[model samples]
Target: PGMGEAQAVPYLMGHVPEGVTAGTHYLQAISTGAVFMGAVTYIGNAPNFMVKAIAEEGGVPMPSFFGYMLRFSIPFLVVNFIILSLIFF
Candidate 1:
């Protein structure tokens, strides 16, 4: 009941999307989708910024936010995320 949607098992309790059912299968799919989409941009994921900070401190020049998306995420992650969404969500 309390924070059930946080685990994706809202089930007539927590906040759910407009048409999505509150269930284990949807929960898993949504969680997986969140992970995949979060990789699409630095700001989308907190760990990305942490890693960038660590790498820069170590003398590795990380791309800027948009640059990372243009050079890496869009080319690498977006397509895969799209495919995953199509298949799962």
Candidate 2:
């Protein structure tokens, strides 16, 4: 279950290009970014799919995987990410 820190951290450390820190802050930043970016796709988060399933079963029409991205995530979340990047970087 601890795949991220156990396996991923080692693999990422080994593959990191020369001059890259691969330090605690960098790892934390990437981990946090991964969490935030997960919202970009339904499959990226398990509860998203579960909630979608529950809603559909209750007679709600949920968007398809790509439909959700194109209709909502790209327009809303991606724009916010762009703005955040501009401000932060």
Candidate 3:
């Protein structure tokens, strides 16, 4: 949850399906993960940090990491992901 596709591509590349070649399937896997999972946490993408910086600069109180997790991420994203996976995947 603390990365973007630029940082996550390598791991996705390494975990490609056994039969999949280094072309369409490989790219698809990386892209899909980047799109869906990228929103799971504040550090999951570049914009998150930018937003935090801007908010703090503007004097808006931002949630701490653990607080964000407990108050928002886990309660919303994780549960929604589980339900979505069960229904779709």
Q: Candidate 2 on 34-63: residue-level lDDT in tens?
A: 866898899889999999999999999999
Q: In model 3, which range of ten residues has the least summed lDDT? A: 24-33
Which tens-of-lDDT digit does each residue in 1-89 have in candidate 1?
55555565655444555776548787888898788787788888788889999999999988998898899988889888878778877
All candidates' TM-scores? 0.62, 0.65, 0.60
Question: Which residue pairs clash within candidate 1?
Answer: none
- Candidate 2 deviates by what RMSD? 6.9
lDDT per residue as tens, model 3, 1-89: 68897979988878887876657665765665576577777888889889989999999999986887789888888787768656654
In order of lDDT, best first, we have 2, 1, 3
**Which candidate wins on lDDT?**
2
**Who is ahead in TM-score, 1 or 3?**
1
Candidate with better lDDT, 1 vs 2: 2
lDDT of each: 0.80, 0.83, 0.78
Full ranking by TM-score: 2, 1, 3
Pairing residues by index, what is the TM-score of model 3? 0.60
* Better model by lDDT: candidate 1 vs candidate 3: 1
Off by over 4 Å in 3: 1-33
